[model samples]
Target: MKNIIITGTSRGIGYELAWQFADAGHNVLAISRKTPQTLLGNKNITCLSVDLSDETEMEKVDNFLSHSWKTVDIIIHNAGSLLLKPFSETSQEDFENIYKVNVFGVANLTRACLPYLQKGSHVVTISSMGGIQGSLKFAGLAAYSSSKGAVITLSELLAEEYKEKGVSFNVLALGAVQTEMLQEAFPGYEAPITAKEMADYIFDFALTGNKYYNGKVLQVSSTNP
Candidate 1:
């Protein structure tokens, strides 16, 4: 019933959210670097190919938003990157790319869409527990973790700035879910949670965009661990 814009829809949480929302009867704007074959036939879903890391392409994002949707009820920034190399091994290019999407891309997209966001609109970003509290197990996550932390902080600031207008901003600090990204991050590792389950919970949690939940981190994991 809502018009939602979701980024990173090529796979993982973004793809799941796009389908879930479409199944719930909402009109979904699914943006990603490439359109997924699975979502090509959905009438209620519109897929946009976007390179979110390219800040220069923000105008394309705006044009897409303007053409496809008149009003945006939700904006879910689920696009993220992971650099799993030790700080010493991480390259400057990796840092820039991570920040480009994880930080600046979100900022630019939101700014461009704000003009269309109604008073009751919601803006959500996916964060991580690693961003919440750095884990020693996550050896090469400095760039990714800091970018996520930036997301959480940005959500808080957005909530404050838009509080008077009845718009809400929230962050979901997700734990490991069985997704391609997880597999890529920790190859050969097993996870107790699936991306579908995580997406389901996130969709439900979004229904309760109370002021208390706004500007807060909703961390989800298997068995609440």
Candidate 2:
């Protein structure tokens, strides 16, 4: 079984992803701002409290993982922040906070874990379709969209850099899924995909050991018609 680390595991997609990995019999290191509600009885899962907003906490996580695991087979940079405010009205503080978690926080965690990542290990980042297309259809998401765009770029760069090292990077560029984050920004909105379903697909993709998927952004949505 693979030793996997996933961030933002308190709820929604993160929560679902943790459960999926654990059920697959992999050792999971789940990280989040608070202990997750879903990992209550899973022995395969280890939940670590980490506020990605705090760089110090992320550093602690880095150190902990480096000391504990000989190597990580998978690292999922899934914790993210979104500020649903118009660009014109977005406060400076919110912008900074968004970038802090979405951009800088991701970078720090990846850098910290790089040393422990071995050949054939995979790095997955949860990006958004917004990162590819600047669809203003969703109002007040400039900060969020811009940050996701940065992630797309980061994934590309890592794919090229890690190719020779036998590491792979894939960005799951997801469409709207039903999650608390979604409801918070778009109340009563209906989405075609659910978080649990998306999590299942991601787990499957990661295990395929297919190098062709490397450095590519895979978009997912409900296959339900």
Candidate 3:
């Protein structure tokens, strides 16, 4: 059983990932701004209420790791913000808010957990297809897409920096998964993939990705143009 930490577990993909991992007999530490009702009674799951964008609140993760876990086998950075607006209408505050949760928050949490990450551990950050160059692009998502682009780059750089340590870092640039976030971003749109399906794939990848991948941004999309 591995010790896994997942952020943004209150709903959608993160919540499903936490459930799947715990059901598979792993020790799961779930972090989110609000606690999910479904995870309240699970023995294998420990929930931490935290706002990833808040450095002071994120310190609680360090404290939890110091007392509860010695080695982290997997860390999935899934917390993010989606700010959809035309570039010309996007406000500075919108950009900052999106970056805070999607980019800076991931950096801060990963930095805090570095000391506890053991050899052969995996770190996966969820990006978006919109962030990939030459892929299908959409308007009104400047801040969200740019933040994910930063996440992809950050994952690659960290993988290079930690190559010798045996810690693998990768990013999953996901397509439109059926979730509240997707609906909010693209109302009345139908996504081919579901959050539970994405969670299953991510759970499997987190378990074995180090064997075949590192420092790479893999796109998880099912859209055809």
* RMSD each, Å: 1.7, 2.3, 0.9
TM-score of every model versus the real structure: 0.94, 0.92, 0.98
* Residues 85-189 of candidate 1: C-alpha lDDT, one tens digit per residue: 889988889899999989998998898888888777888888887778544236788899889888888999998998898889998888888889889989998
Segments of candidate 3 deviating more than 4 angstroms: none
Q: How big is the positional error of residue 159 in model 1, measured in Å on the Cα after superposition?
A: 0.8
Off by over 4 Å in 1: 134-137, 223-225
Q: Which candidate leads in TM-score?
A: 3
Q: What does candidate 2's lDDT look like per residue over 1-225, in tens digits? A: 999999889988889889888987998999987896669689999888877777777677777776777788998888889888878899889888999899887888888788888889998898887777644346689889889989989988989998998899888878888889989988999888888887878777777734668888876644311
Best-performing candidate as measured by lDDT: 3
**What lDDT, from 0 to 1, does candidate 3 have?**
0.92
Q: How far does residue 155 in candidate 1 sit from its true spot (Å)?
A: 0.8
* Tens digit per residue, CA lDDT, model 3, 12-93: 9999999999999999999999998789899999999999888888689988999989889999999888987889998899
Candidate 2 is scored at a TM of: 0.92
**Model 2, residue 141: displacement in angstroms?**
0.3
